[model samples]
Target: MQIEPMATATEPTRKIVQRDPARTRARILKAAIAEFSAKGYSGARTVQIATRAKSNIRMLYHYFGGKDALYVRVLEEVLLRLRAAELQLDFESMEPTDGILKMFDFIDTHFGARPELRRLLAFENMNQARHLNRSAVIRDAASPVLGHIANLLRRGEQAGVFRPGIDALHLYTAMVSLAYYSRAHAPTLSRIFGTDLLCHQWQADHHAQSHQMLLGFLSRPTTA
Candidate 1:
């Protein structure tokens, strides 16, 4: 018995296990974004999101309530990230023309980084009031960023920099439309245009041209 102590099968080695709730939540959020982006809120399913997240339905609900709640949370998170990025532009230091260009650059980068955001937003627009109401808390949170942009526009107008007659809100809407619509509808546009409208080179050129065009439209007129 003591002889060669029957080499006890080294107690099956055990791998250390670590639980990462935060990481799991992030994974769920990421999967939810893709799911909702692909199928609008009405069409999106919680089980699908959970499955994509490699998580269980019960865990998904526990973390984010039901589908509607999860959709709202996803939108809120997206808006928060967008606001943070937009806020980094130092409008106070930038000339109106330069600021407008900076905004275009910012939007271009944002869309590139999060194409799904545009898709998700397109879905939201299909049922504007319903989705907006569901995410009202996030919209409320966005007021500060909106106010900051409005203030910048006011200052630009007062300083005789930006065109005087354009409404800031309208201008903001136009800017957003320009940035989002092209990419969002790229496939359709490419088919109609008989070219790859979203090709890397095309997008780069289009972005620069669009930024220049907007800047030209917004800049103060030169008197003869």
Candidate 2:
């Protein structure tokens, strides 16, 4: 007689509990930033973002609508993060000159520390700010800092410390470019000069230099 195989007990399949929508959205955004920062907007994939987020593509769409929308949202979120840090500076509490100089120093720390934020900015710049241009929220987020810079300049002018008729936006743009230049061009600069701008000492020294240059420009007398 042939022996029959013994019957096996089948185990019940475990059901995945649905994560809260808010949590899932946050996770997707976090994962998308990593994905976008690593691959840039044009190269990022929704499926890979979902995989990195530990969710499904369906869920990613459910949270952010689509890839383009998600990419735009990623840019918004990164700018919002940077703006939030800037908003914490309390520029009004300090002396105008000190505040302006501190802002430059803060940029050194903020931009140097937040490499992903810088990468996103660089990527967005490469795209000619097309994605960044799509959001009104960015304007709102940026307005406060520009306003603070304007206020700082006005106060300096009133106190006869800063030069008269200085355009706040121009000065603000100059400060950013000066503060951002080293980190933005670090690889090329380091190769050329045989010095690493990424080093802490170099960053600190450059921060001082930026602070000095910006302060000097702001305080210099206007010649007709």
Winning candidate number (lDDT): 2
Put down candidate 1 lDDT per residue, 93-183, tens digits, no spaces.
Answer: 8776677677767877797779878988888888874766766677677676667667767778898987777766677777777778788
Residue-level lDDT tens digits of model 2 in 74-96: 98997788788888998888899
TM-score of each: 0.84, 0.89
Residue pair clashes in candidate 1? none
Off by over 4 Å in 1: 1-18
Winner by TM-score? 2
Error of 2 at 188 (Å): 1.4
Error in Å for residue 16 of model 1: 8.0
Alpha carbon deviation, residue 81, candidate 2 (Å): 1.3
Candidate models: Cα lDDT each: 0.80, 0.86
RMSD per model, one decimal: 3.4, 4.1
lDDT of 1: 0.80
> Runs in model 2 with CA error above 4 Å?
1-18, 222-224
